[model samples]
Target: MRIALIYPPPWKIAAREETVSYGHDGPPPGHRPQDLDADFYQTPYGLFTLGAEALRAGHRVKVLNLSAYAWSRVEEVIAGLDADVFGMSCWTANRRGVALTARCIREHHPKAHIVVGGPHATPLATEMLEHHPEIDTVSLGESDATFLELLGRLELGKPTSGIAGTVYREGDAIRKGPERRAIHDLDTLASPHTYFDTHIVMTSRGCPWACTFCGAETTWGRGFRGHSVRYVLDALERVLARLPVKMLQIKDDTFTTNKKRVLELCHGIRERGLQFFWSCDTRVDLLTEPLLREMRLAGCQRLSLGVESGSQAILDAIDKKITPDEILESTEMAKRVGIKVRYYMMLGNRGETRHTFQETLDFLDRARPHEYIFSCLSIYPGTRDFHDAEAAGFVDREVFFTETFQELKTPFDASEEDTHRMNEWFFANSGLRIVHRDGVADYRAILERLGDYHAAHMDLGAALYHAGDLEGAEHHVRRALELGYPLPGLVHNHLACIAHARGDLDGMMNHFSHAAKVDPQHFVLIQNVNAARAWFKQGGPGRKLPLQLTVRHDFQLLERTVQPTLPGPLPEDWKAWNAIALPAEPSATYLRTPDVEGSQHVLKTRTRLKVVV
Candidate 1:
């Protein structure tokens, strides 16, 4: 039977009931989904997993990531693909959007069975099926085997409610079926990489640690089960042979949780002589110098560490089980071996206070990771923190069910307003962003949220320019300069590129000079810098002042004295170096010997110029 797997648009949440407002042009007020690169959405790995399994079982499967597509386009796309089953994977935030999508698919393909699964649906299996009439089934826990079996039974036109780890609607009542055992041998699962963009290789399933704020352990259980070394290598080989993916992210809760396995994987990769730049995340306490070194040799480009907080009390409170010293050592080891470190930090966790925040800042000052993303502590369903928060009357499951991701609120000493302000301050002071989708908000929010901050506006401007919005690009870039966006040099460099594009030599030279004064390190800026320096020696470009120079060719002037400079403002040190060309076949030639200044710039060419200015 034909199956359609969907990664819903940004707006949907799995628990989205019949009565919530989500189909508006924008996301719900005070709510934004944490997308990782909004411009290009990652393939929903869960959908890929289920789809791959379904495909392998001799069932036809079609998958779509509707995150990047506009909400209106969703219906148009879904209507075209006819399938027997419509399956969607959603996060808690996208619960409303998933329900909306389900409604759309239902309207078009009413005969198709709708199955919703993911972190959001897995927890509230009964609640989701009951609340959302559009939903036919909610897959709970591990769905790879469960879904495969469910689809087979459905193809045979049988009842689905009795399927393990699944909740389905029957006779106006929501009922859950038998619990399916977690797949102990993860290698039996098909490689989802062949189906979608990201080769999100989950080397292992389940996290042993019971971090209070995280809901991972709840969903996958506490036992850490990993695919064998050969299984992993074989999976990678399959993906590489079938597709052209240069990078593979080994998405394990803690990649190095099994040190011997990691070493073996690294060694296996090297033995096969297969190389690809990859990344993985792990706990700070799990890292060691030797293991990291092996990973580096195996072409690990980035290492993401969860240095959630600096306060020992807060760390212990959250059951992080990682010390500040361990964080530093791990960061140092990763950096020393040339693996760029990315930190995942959470603020406003248990025992969080202004003092703890400052402690985190201090720790960051010492650790100095390459990059980091921050998040306010999230209390998702099935987490210890969630249960405690609920018990304390801080949050209700009904509200959580209705609002989904937006319902999560961090219970910190600081007020919501204060936490938000602190988050911005943390970004400005500590120089770290959050783990959010690098989408339109990510670029526009800097100015809209922070009120004209400079650093990334240039980036936004460039992005706008590339998107054919020349006016918007120019405005943002100009605003960036006005707000003293830390990298003013880039502003001048950008202006130089525009000037160069418009064939304005003086404009290009003037901006290039300003950029060079500010130390042009970026490639384009460096090009303009070098060009400006070469075009004029003492007086910079844009200087309308013309030097009367004569290129005397055997006492005869061979060139014009008046050289036209392009229109725009000139630099302070603009100069015109005039010279006569003297080739090897020429009867007369003039050459300058080395001067006191150790600039050994030889003017060797097809012909050299003799200066008579």
Candidate 2:
């Protein structure tokens, strides 16, 4: 049987530009004040893995990432792959795009078994097939085995009624099955990297901790199932031989859940002499100083902690099963071991309020993470939070998934105005702290800038300053200036932020002066703008805090240019794309990394950098 797996583009910007405009009142459900969640898109490793499974089952499979392609062009791309089955991955953010692509594919091949899988499809399986007649069936969870089984039955012209872990309509009635039994021996399966030179490695099948906001259980089933240390080592060796990637992100739910396995994996890396800087995400309570030190010695350059909120009450409310103290101490441990820490922060959960926001800010000041990744609380199907919200009448599944994101159900405990204020103030002050003390952030931005990335670096710089890494933040902000940023006043404003944070009144005023000289629209130059921005940083509502101003990339051609650049798919010779040094453009988002001056911070990053869902 022939199969084709396609991952659709993430955005509908061309079709919904007018409807997607930013709101001045409050940030949307998907956006943080720092950047739109759409800024990054990664390879659909799930579909690729399924393709690998199909290959092992003696079925032909083709994998394609049409993420950057316009939705209208999906039909054009699908024609290239004439297969008996078409599998598409779905996510809430890209559900509409998936539907559009599915309809086009259906138009071209009416008889093909068009199946949808992934976060969005796994929970809303029956509803998805019901709401959109184009989709033939929705695969429930752990589809590697199910998809392979599906193809064999189809080849034999058999009914799919026997298949477990799938939902489909049968004579006006919907049939649903429990998720497929979890794959115990993960090593038995072929790594997706073999089919596509991917950078993500999932050494585990499920998560042990059930966070209220996460949908891991809905898709992967309950409990943790990690691959043997030898299995992970074998997979790592395979990737090392295939791609020239320097860093491999271990895409696991709480990679440190099994400390014994992690230790063995680190030992395996040393024994094998596989050289690469790797990172993984895990809960704060799972890490120990000794474990972190061992990890660093084994070439783990970074550790990402899901420090979702700073407020202890909020943490308890979300069932994060972690304390604020654990978060701080974990950062200290990772820092002691020379592993840069990246904190994944979320605001506007069940218990969030002005008081909780203040607690979050206070925690940020104390923990001093090397970076802060900000996000707003978002609802997904099948998560505990989603069910609670539905039962409470906060959202209606009838239109929630099919229609435009409803901002009225936004989960923040504070009023819309207060939420807006929190976002703006946190972004501004966070930059001053991160830059002044913590250190530089991950070089992901530096690698991205070598392509079509075009965010204002001052935004990042400001974030860094607030996290307490002033020099690193300044390095980037100045790089932004060197790249001829369209708004220099923002740069001046940020420099002033750094100065003001460190008690340099003269230096603070100096930057503010430069900001005013260049553009009178500087936050510090505008009446009350500086006051509002500094209010959180200085802890006051009406008191004059301090001098404040606010704000807040290039590309190159290669020999045989790669079109629709990074964060998108490669045409061919993708391995070569990963192995070469990238040229820089003056207008691209510039970032300073530990790499030598004038060198691109290359990771041979996956077309989409890998992160756990």
Candidate 3:
């Protein structure tokens, strides 16, 4: 049996513009935004675990990272793979891209069996099947065992009705199986690192906290499930055998959830002399000097603390369960222990306002985590915040996910204009200078003074581009470039957009090429370069010239040399693509048509494939 795991690309905004500052004040003097590459090393734990399971079952397994690869090249990569089954993992942000990828695979290989899993699928199983006919099954909940079982049944040419937690198509109807049991014994599961040859490991499953905006509780439940200390150390040993294992990214929602267990694990790592650096996520309140010192001694290089809000009101509203004092103390303690700390802040929570937003700024100034991540909250289905928003009259019940504006879905009950203003203020104030006055009401004045010159011009250029005023956009962009602004990557990207709009194919290519050159390691710029190349090769009407920007020596080599590889088997024709196996027992009603408009346009077509057995 052959299995292919596909991780779709992230949203353009998140992948390109969202930098993983971890807690840095801002991008270096002249910082540029770039695309986030989906390295095999960075592949999600679930996908790697499932891949390892498939391999353990004697199936040929491959990982197709379409996220790291440009969208245009997806078909080429799919055409190059050789596999029997295709599996895809997607989050809410990248659902559209996943759907598009599934459709493309079905169009190219109609006989290949397709499956969709991950956080997105768990809550939207019915919607996924109804919306995308090309997907043969949606593996709801934990899929490591269920997926392997489904593969076994398929290989034997047997009916898959016995396999629980799967939704598949049968004739004109879709059939869903009974809910599968979750993995209780963590030791039985193989290390995901075995499949990827990477150092990433999951020490625990499930989050202890119920953050209002998070969907983790709904997907994995609130109770924390962890592997034994022995199991974790064994996994680490296995990983160190294969790779240099510089950084062990513990993909636990809260590594410090079980204080005793974490301490035990830390002690084990120290005793074993693992001599490897690691990072983990934890709550601000969980940090203690003892734990921090023990972790640092055991090579815990970094910690990501979710200081979701600085305002006590917002924190309580979201059940963040930490106070400002706790946040400050935790930061100071981590810094004292010589441990790098990254603060993950949520900007748009319930009860967010100009005042509360300012409180966050003041908190950052006080706490001073190594990096600050300010993100607008998203109202995902199944979260308490989502229901609360509807209950509080923020979101209309009639509005579907697609119809809801991205900014409006935030837990923060504020106008879009206000949100934008706060976003601008957060970025501007996160720099070296204190550009904002504590009691000043002059928003525009503060923006003009504290904001990066190039960043402001870039914003204006972006507005013009969105307004379809390409020429005006180009003029502002050129001004940004000529100002000798430090953010060359952003400047180059805007120039690319201008070139794209003005029918300057060479100029578009040159700008993207320049952006990529300036920040060769930046995934966003790399993606832009790939997109530009693909568009140009397709004879599109845009700039097609290469960039002339300079970059760091190693980064330049990485850009020129690194190429993403395909994950699964390729099919010759579209007719052999596999359809999702519908459930034998109907538990819910299936709508003939999806609730949203244009959904049918995006729906995937199904094809029949012959079983290998």
lDDT of each: 0.64, 0.64, 0.62
Better of 2 and 3 by TM-score: 2
Q: Write the per-residue lDDT of candidate 2 for residues 1-613, one digit (tens) a residue.
A: 7777777764443333335442321222354322323223454668767877877777766666666554445556676556789998898766766777788778888888898999878877877877788887788878888888778889999877647888876767778765578787788888776655656678897888888889999888889988889878888888767553345778798899999999989988878877665778898999898788668656676677899898878898988989998998898877655566878777667777778878887888887886766556667888888888678664566653345442222553456666666656644433212322332353334324332211234445666776788987787788767765544655676777777667676776687777677754322334334563466467652465544344331111111111222233344442222322222222122112111111111111112212122
Task: Give the least accurate 10-residue stretch of model 3, judged by summed lDDT.
Answer: 597-606
Sequence-dependent TM-score of model 1? 0.68
Residues 419-465 of candidate 3 have per-residue lDDT tens digits of 66676664443321212121112222322543433333544565666
* lDDT per residue (tens digit) for residues 547-603 in model 1: 221110000011111111001111222211121100112112111111111111111
| TM-score winner | 2
lDDT of 1 at 387: 79
Q: How many clashes in each structure? A: 23, 36, 44
Off by over 4 Å in 1: 12-26, 30-40, 194-197, 242-245, 404-409, 412-421, 424-613
The ten-residue window of minimal lDDT in model 1 covers 551-560
Instruction: Report the CA-based lDDT of candidate 3 relative to the real structure.
Output: 0.62
